[model samples]
Target: MKTESLSQLLSFLDASPTPFHAVDALRNRLNAFGFEELLEQESWKIHPGSKYFVVRGDTSIAAWIQGTESPSVTGFRLIGAHTDSPNLRIKPQPDLNQHGYLQFGVEVYGGALLSSWADRDLSLGWNDLPEKQNRKNRRTLFFIILNRF
Candidate 1:
């Protein structure tokens, strides 16, 4: 890959710490490429030679560009990929005070290496759901430095 493309990929990775954030980043990129968003709850008016994308549960996304030819004549091309990876996630009740230091309790979501995570900068990202029905959920990202004393 080119240096510029690698830099952009690194920036995207930094912006996406969780599945929700990754989908959000992908949606933005697709929008920049002229892909229109499609909601599952609504009906779609698909057009040939147009780009579109759909998101589900704030974590999953699918994007496609429609071909001008019919599927029976040209066939379809598909690609599949996932955004999640092994990482540490904060527990619901994460606050802890030990030895005059504040800390958070975390859970291993996948095959995360607990030892490798020690004494390094970490990022926590999550979707903040609103209590009110009319309010919209927000995406939150936080960074912290962990030190072994």
Candidate 2:
């Protein structure tokens, strides 16, 4: 792998802290490559030699490029990938005051290595929904590191 490619990958990882953020980053990249976003509720008119993408529930995404040849003549090729990984998720009521220390209640979302996470720097990222129905949801990323004496 080239240094430039590695740098880009690191940048992508840094930008994507949650599944929603990863899908958004992917959508932006696809848009830059001439891919049109298709909504699940809307009708789609797919044509040959065109690029199209669809996002589901703001977490999953699918993008494809149509070939000039028919499906019967040239078989389709599909690739599968996931943006989710082992991580901790904050609960709805995460604030906990224990022994004069303010802590957050978190749950493991996947097969996270809890032992490995001890004394390591971590960040919290989430989609903040607005109170107004017309307003768009905002993405917020916060970083915090706890050190033990």
Candidate 3:
């Protein structure tokens, strides 16, 4: 992992108010590494050493790093803890009228000290692609399951 790129991740997350925006940040970073963008509605043919990504809707994100083996079962070790810090989010119908100040409606995810976020800047990333209930809706937006570190 590149330390410079990894360090910038926090700031990038801070800039992305939503997960979709976060993926956009990641996409740019991955482009530097020569990864190709996969079409959302296109078919995928998996092989060795081919990196690709997909977005589901608006909330989730995911990606994969290719391995040399044809089956690509190269396992080394999973280092580093996956961390998701708590922060604020804009309400679906959010406005600045509440408290006469601009703020976000944040819900704590996993296990975090919610009180601390009141003073800290937050960074967010996305993962997972779950099936949406409505099939009739055309996918103007895509959800991504975070796959790249």
Give per-model TM-scores.
Answer: 0.80, 0.83, 0.49
Residue range 18-113, candidate 3, lDDT tens digits: 555665666666778777766678887766677766555544445676677644465644333222344444446554556677754655455666
lDDT values of the candidates? Answer: 0.83, 0.84, 0.56
Model 1: per-residue Cα lDDT over 21-123, one tens digit each = 8998998899998999998989999999999999987889999999999999999999999889898777988999999998989887888777977767655
Best by TM-score: 2
Q: Candidate 1 or 2, higher lDDT?
A: 2
Higher-TM-score candidate among 1 and 3? 1
The TM-score that candidate 2 achieves is: 0.83
Predictions: Cα RMSD each: 2.7, 2.6, 9.0
> What global local distance difference test value does model 3 have?
0.56
Pick the lDDT winner. 2
What's model 3's lDDT at 12? Answer: 84
